[model samples]
Target: MAIAIAADELESLFDALPDVVFFVKDAAGRYTHANLTLVRRLGLKRREQVIGHGVAELFPAHMGGSYAAQDRRVLGGETIDDQLEVHIFPNRAPGWCLTRKHPLRVRGKVRGVVGISRDLGRPDARDPTYERLRRVIDHLQQHYADNVRMAKLAELAGVSLAQLERHFRNVFQITPQQALIRLRIEAAMHALGTEGSIADVGVACGFADQSAFARQFKATVGMTPSAYRRMTSTKE
Candidate 1:
């Protein structure tokens, strides 16, 4: 059954969260409703300014175009979950976030998209599972370039795969695999700033090959590795 709450209520509720950008987009991928955080990050003073605009209109050309493609996938009924992304918005801290988008359905028919991009927060160190997961996290940080295995992580956590997944999510807000990918991508991003070849950077970051690295890098960073290199170079 569809929830009875209205979109406006959801928008208002999300507005209290300054670290989350929340929105509802119509079938055409135009924003129908947005929270204050999203409006402000877009460099707008009012929600009305963001409404009726698509990502292609709100972000830079490259980033907006990539986001528009992602919207199309969600509008086609794909649910994007815990996708790590980099955001460089006006009047906001530049950092990585986890984004999720789900297709909104009405009467069993696809209607629109509802989503949120939340800034990555610190881990819950007070959680009982934190100590157990810390071992796994440390191993990843030390050997992110290696082909890390999930079974090894589960063993280190002293839990079954299912329990490890649950505990990791509770503490980190992302799956262990997602955590590993983030580590590798961050390493790659830093490596790209140097004089290293793009292929070498990909291999050094544990990706299977240059193509795989480029694909994942673009999806997460909203630009290709070469383009990212050029952007950084221009800023230098």
Candidate 2:
């Protein structure tokens, strides 16, 4: 025999989970429903405020624009699975999260998107393997402007190249190389907010050239660095 949970009960279960945000958006990218976790993370006093609102209404332009593009992708019948990316918390803190989005289909037509984002706790504090990987992550963060070597990271973690890749995937669901790129992209995002030249920002973030930085930045952020900088600058 098996037990079945009601719809409301299932929703309550999702609401009770800590550090997990859940949401549903319509084809137009309007919020149709959001869990309490999402509501709180958006700093909304009530879920009603989130209903019918778009990401642009709830978040800054740079972040919201990325989210809107993601919604469009899902609504176009695409599924995004277990992507490692940065998220903004309710208190305005930036953190990494494993995010997934799927298209909601009704009668074989894509109606909207349903998504969840699970916060990744401090990279250094997750477990013994993660603790070991922390040294590499810390070094990457500190030296994002310089070329990073996987062999050196493996050496720092007291592991071989294969083991380092395995551990990084097991613990962070990303390759060490991907993590390094993410770090550089994050650093570039921060640098874009300053008065520095775009090429200078790319150089500071370890890209081989401004073209390379723009390519990677657009791939990861869903917009060019110049567009992001313009949107964020206007917001500020």
| Highest lDDT model number | 1
Instruction: Report model 1's TM-score to 2 decimal places.
Output: 0.91
Any residue pairs clashing in model 2, and if so which? Answer: none
TM-score of each model, paired residue for residue: 0.91, 0.74
lDDT tens digits, residue span 129-224, model 1: 999999999999998899999999999999999999999999998889989989998899889989999999999999999999999998988888
Off by over 4 Å in 2: 1-10, 89-91, 124-135, 138-143, 149-163, 189-194, 214-236
Which prediction has the highest TM-score against the true structure? 1
lDDT of each: 0.89, 0.80
- Please provide, for model 2 over 55-134, each residue's C-alpha lDDT reduced to its tens digit, 9 standing for 90 to 100: 99998676687888888888888899877776656554566677899997767999778788887654444556978898
Off by over 4 Å in 1: 1-5, 91-93
The 10 consecutive residues of candidate 1 with the worst lDDT sum are 87-96
